[model samples]
Target: MILVTGATGHLGRAVLDTLLQHTAAHQLAALVRDPAKATDLQARGVSLRVGSYTDPASLAAAMPGIDTVLLISGGGDDDGLQQHQNVIDAARQAGVRRVAYTSRALQDPGTLANELMVRHFQTEDYLKASGLGYILFRNILYMDTLPLFTGPTVLETGINLPGGEGQVSYALRSEMGEAIANVLLQDFTDSRIYHFTGAAAYSFHDVAAALALASGRPVVYHDVAPEVLAARMRERGVPEVAIGRTIGFMTDIKHGQESLVSSDLAAALGRQPTGLLEGIKQLYQL
Candidate 1:
């Protein structure tokens, strides 16, 4: 059986959709914190199991007859690393043959952003310590986030952040989903790490150009220092903690390290991933 955790999330839902295309209904399971939130997926043939990465017993209970488990990362908590370890432990005890994980792109893996990748590293440590076969989906930021950047909010408020000309290895969540599904179904006897991004690399300037072309307006780009951006976010009523995290993300992206293209995702899916301009056209109907 193929079991997917965080099935209610955007990436998890896409994985479940991809899994359904390749496997039978009885062979699929989805872990959710609330079964009712998964009513639509449940009706579509996924076995719903209520569980959390923070709860080992819950993960074990959710792993019945499961040969593979996709551990989606958790967010917005202090103990996220411990939570991921809990899931890995339960998967080991449950005898799951292979486990697929969602990890952030650390680029060089030795920079300040490597701290951002701590959860993934700790999880990997636990999996290896347990002697379980595993696959890692190291995903970069998604370019589809362009809409939000060019959204009504940003449009009305104006674009303001760091990295004016900085390039980003932005990708579509759809492509990330495709890559993860491929890894889960493939015979990854040897553990593997797959970094993911769209076929093309895009920069904030490129995104601004796309938005202007799509919206038929002269959208302007505004770049600011990290502290300035944080202060502005606070003035705009963004919470202090969220402001710090947002600044950190911008700081990481400004290094332009995660902005490069990697064909690993193409190799994984056996096709080129979606491109920036094309995705914007499809999404915005330009």
Candidate 2:
């Protein structure tokens, strides 16, 4: 059986939805901290293994009878590296054949001083050292986050950021989940890594044009300075830490860190991934 950690989260749920289409529900299990939150999954005949990555004992108890485990990256404020280690160790102890990890798609995570990417790199290193076979899904930024970066009134105010002209090969989260599920259904004898990304890299200017086409209204992209963007966030009462993180990601884009386009996502899906204009329309419901 296959078990997915963080089963109640957005990407986890999307993976489960696609898995259910190709396999029987009884062949799947979910690793959840609270079974109450996963009642829908239990009703669908998927076994629920209550566990927490912070609690090694819980993770160990959740691993019996599972052939493979998908360790979805944690999003909490706590130490994520140790949590991932706990899961990996538990899976190893339980004799799980393979462990799949969701990681960031960066050519060199050390280029930037971002703490999150550092942890991802650390986790990947630890997983590699662990004796079990592994699959690494180095995913790029999601198209779903476009709304968060640009405000709700983006159609009127335009896309203003410090990302400069650098482009991101952003893939839809749902499509990435589907591709991950496809990998999970296959044999896990050989370990592999995939750079899951969209078909093309696009800049904020391309995003503006896509928005204009989708909404049938004029839109613009303003390449503001980092200090100017930070000042605007301060005016809007955004937290200082969040402002720093936002600027850090924009800087990574400015340096072309997320500009690599890969065909792995489309190869997994057996078709070309959605283009920017179509993805924008789907995201905005336009």
Q: lDDT per prediction? A: 0.77, 0.92
* Model 1 lDDT tens row, 127-173: 77778888888888776666654445554455677765667777788
- What value of lDDT does candidate 1 attain over all alpha carbons? 0.77
Q: Among these predicted structures, which one has the highest lDDT?
A: 2
Lowest lDDT 10-mer window, candidate 2?
107-116
Q: Could you list the CA RMSD of all candidates, in the order they appear? A: 2.1, 1.2
TM per prediction: 0.92, 0.97
Error of 2 at 152 (Å): 0.5
Q: Which pairs, if any, clash in model 1?
A: 168-259, 169-259
